[model samples]
Target: MRFFDRTCLSSLLGASLVAGSLAATPVLARQPDGPVDLTAQAQPAKPAPTKPAPATPAPKPSTPAPSAAAPSPLAVPSTSATPVVEEPDTLPVAHWTLADAQSLLATIRGIGAEGLFARDYEPANLAAAIKVGEGDALDQLASRLFVWLAEDLRDGRTPMTARVQWFAVDPDQDNHPNAQLLAQATETHDIKGVLAGLSPKHPDYALLKDMLSKTKDPKQIAMIRANMDRWRWLGQDLGLQYLIINVPEQELRLTVNNQIIRTYRAIVGKPGRTATPQLAEQVRNVVFNPTWTVPQSIVVGEGLGARLIGNPRQAAREGYVATKNADGTITVVQQPGENNALGRVKLDMPNEHAIYIHDTPSRQLFAQPQRALSHGCIRAERATELAMTMAILGADLPPETAVEYNLSGKYTKVPMTKPWAVYITYFTVARDVNGVMRSFADLYGRDPAVIASFAKPRELHTSQRKSNEAVIKLDNPL
Candidate 1:
């Protein structure tokens, strides 16, 4: 299969693009009240250090800190000062000992176990530099190679061009800075251990690695490798509690302490322009008995507004409130009711995509095997239960209060005392809800680019953390 169009490949092979620096802005925490404001929040600036902090040894991968606050929006720059190096000379060289150089060469040579090619790091060149007996040449070559390997392990091996519609900003680099890792590796001479620490902390990566070792078929190995790399694209530690939705699997999982607490069937965006984009967002509020403001595309283009304006009785019966403006435009809102587009609850996670998870009035849609049915947003099955659970877990709301809010048939927004991370991910090869390893159909045909990237030489990591595609706000649940 053709992985990329000519235009896309041309852009990928062209000069690396430098991402502009983002000015940090303060974000004010909002109280749970009316509808959620989906504005993007900037990451606050960190204070400069007066002296270099002691380099702490890398810790073993454990459950992520439960109380850590959600990260800033995808557009927000990483707090880590790790430079995106386009060339070997771009990075600062660190003094390398002969022993450390030997260890690094061995680590690079055996990188294939992590689905990375050692040749990409120029292992031969590093070995030759080591033969010349530890000098600036050896230090410079080893440092550059180490940075490249660390970047691939921490961020991902796939270039931005191959990752279609992906907006999830990985925070691994911030957690494990490349320069810091390089220094730590040289100081401790534990080259392998330091680099190995960069692997994604998620269990799925380990499982995929195991599968890769056992699988004999070339195709299956490629699939496993691609999925393994997908894990690296996300944050190393995916918090103590989070919600993960696998779009192709049509599954939503509520995981706590690396175990699945609950699973919900999900109806994701339809394939094509409305196909759901991968995202990493935080659920800030839970809206019970939510209202739906009809978009102009539906109100005008679909003639719903004109019809509602002409038939007031019908509009009222359908739970629609219509108003005619002086500008000859009509406004339409589907009031909170059983027939409302957003069934009983909505998880408010503000981002530029305007995508949210909400209850669906059409419960039968969940039963269909092919659930790529919505415009863009996720239509969750048993949404009231999900919302109640989120309210109790995130907002510390009493179960009774949550039920009351759901049954009250009135709008209520419960702000999260502790916002939970919500990941809308697309994985063609992954464990099903029942914990069975299997492959789902690539509903959006996204796997080819990633699989193809694995076959080609590794590309330099760029400043771009996400796809540069224009943000398409598809709010309509239908």
Candidate 2:
């Protein structure tokens, strides 16, 4: 029975081999020499390959799709980190024509209402030029009109032709600015606006103009007129910050952008030969515990040399250092101390005249109403306060540094970070702290000349006006 079962199994295996060989024949024919294991499971037979159904033509649209490979039309460039540079301020331009000449003439005549000399603008000349109509005459007149407007707008008047002898620190009166003003006036047809823009912005000037327009008192009018002309002496713009000492008022005002920051009582030069000359200078440095090198005139005229000669020991005790020269001339110097003539501080403003602003040992002098007692240099009442204020405003000397040097009580000079511009001026009439116009004593007798200038016939040309200065040889010291 086992032999019969073995024979049947062999016959069944033979039949299975024949079927597997037939199934793998197509695959083996396509890939000859490929591995074919009989033990591996046979994969299901694939159907006969048929041609893919023809792809339906994509429905044609009105607008064709954009090509993905091409650059986009709305692309923006990457932003840069660099800052953009800005252009400088452009000057205003003028836009006046021949038709605007009459308006300009009317505006010119109204300058008198601004406390300015109207005739100086040559209104009659402008009128005549306008009457002549077209050509070079009208062109010249138009040119002159714009130029005058620009000049008056920037600097009240021509100081040189006005016969103002005092040094005018008017850096704003440069030709470039005048040219710009001319351009502006020619570009703008607003005659009244232009005229209004030209006047001094100071409250005092406006106040004087108001008083002159209404007041009838001759003396009062004359005083106001003289003061008006005095405004012409200074630059149109004083500065963002400056020190102005009114000699007649005996007051020193620290002004920033025309507004008074602080007012200080001051002791100015006496009248006549010792009068403080009106000047514009820069405060270069502040010296603490300053020494006084006595002027020759003071040493000899005050009999200080004689005292030193008679009692050298006494002179030494009083801080005087006397040196008798080979020529028998005496040089005197006071050492830095509390009793020094310059007191505890001195502001150095180097000028040809050797002028300075300093402190004084005599604080009582400030209490007096008329405080004109110095030789030439201004004596500030609260000098230490002034020094501290300057140190703060300029930031040249730190508070600690100022305090250290001030308390040290030693002769030391501290240069200003930014030199403060100082104007030692003499104005008999000016506005007070309350904005009320006040008249001061004409300590230097200088009002007559300034006042006389108003009465003098207006010269045809500014150059024709003579210098009012009278050169006099005097025995008195400067």
Candidate 3:
């Protein structure tokens, strides 16, 4: 068995390993400890109180004059009689000609090439409608089927419920509205071309589709189909330049113009609750020689606060500054130094979860093949190099200036001139750093849910964008 398989088996057999002990007290930092308890049972310390800001006064409402327009309870409202106007971009179903309907039928038959089921679009009903000729019956059914097909292609066949910990909001629905697509298809009479355009713009989507065509094994086909839909879960176009971290593979790809420019080994969150949630955020700034703020879980719960409160010498030696707040609460901040937990740099991407990519003092951890070790945040290997590259590319900082900042050993945050995107994604199967197509162990076991979703009939899209799971803000890089 592989290392990941052995580790996963051991974790399963030992419940304590899979889920940290709830009764165990928090411990102070030495080197990085085992996975931190991030479940709801682990209560975080209450934040210190601050004075409330002054509220703005509400304006008084204007009184309306008494009118003699009171209607009886049985009376129909005048506005209810008005005809509903279709949006300017909405193509009338009655306007769809036989040629256009036939073209859509042809596209529906071959949607399986794009990893979609032809039966899901009600192809037989569409064919019957087409046979009857263009009328209300034909128009309504054709239009409805077209819209459904368009939605599945643009958004995804899988519903939100099956996407475990998915938080990336797809903007394609708004950018290419159903009505607008229908209008364009009918106007140009290029139903196949218009529908094909809805596929994800990412190169991986095309690769997956090509693979699906050549593969014959049932399991491989299902896996390819599941991953193909996974691409649809994200935005159609991941920006021109961005950082995409695949959590399962424990690798980060720096992509430029749909091409992989660089790859870095990464240490992702451990299994269970500390497993990193999927996210798409902007890298606003890169901080060099970053400080680490010790959470109260460590400072107070673990007795680190009491130990360092009066021992300035010990605290200085550890590169930490401990202060007792006015509220009798203890605050601990690790200063910038060689001993700092965040080694030398961190990419500041603001999000609800407080997850970010940063350097680690324990670089040896990256040498391990199965690197599901961090609390939740990502630890990038050779992170200083990654940081300096980001500084030059995203912030337009000169190489010498970046070098100076790194050597200065002071916390310096350089803002990006044009913010680049950072996508924290989970893929069980994808191209590895060496550009070889392979499968990684599902460390978090998220693949089953997606694969199961593919077995059922397609579900309707919902308003929910991200996972409804509570955002656990344990920012401990350890």
Cα displacement (Å) at residue 176, model 2:
5.1
Model 3, global lDDT = 0.74
- Name the lDDT value of residue 434 in candidate 2: 41
lDDT of 1 by residue, 1-478 (tens): 0122334433322321112121122222322111111111112232121121122222111211101122212222323333343433257468999998898888877776787666566665667778889777777777877887898898988888788999999988787887789889888888889999888877778866766656655566677778888998999899978999998888787776677666788999999999999999999999998999999999989999989998889999999999999998999999998888998889999999999999988998887778889998998877876787788778888655766787788999999998599999987767665454667888898887787767654666767889988888885787
**How would you encode candidate 2's per-residue C-alpha lDDT over 85-141 as one tens digit per residue?**
222232233434666778777776666665544455556666666676756555554
Worst 10 residues of 2 by lDDT: 23-32
- Cα shift from native, residue 342, model 2 (Å): 1.0
RMSD of 3: 17.8
Please identify model 3 stretches exceeding 4 Å from their true place: 1-94
Q: Give the clashing pairs for model 2.
A: 93-187, 94-183, 94-184, 94-186, 94-187, 94-188, 95-186, 95-187, 95-188
**Which residues of candidate 1, in runs, are more than 4 Å off?**
1-89
RMSD of each: 17.3, 40.8, 17.8
Evaluate all candidate structures by whole-model CA lDDT and list the values in order: 0.75, 0.60, 0.74
Off by over 4 Å in 2: 1-96, 120-125, 145-165, 175-180, 188-196, 300-314, 324-329, 460-478
Q: How would the candidate models be sorted by TM-score, starting from the highest?
A: 1, 3, 2
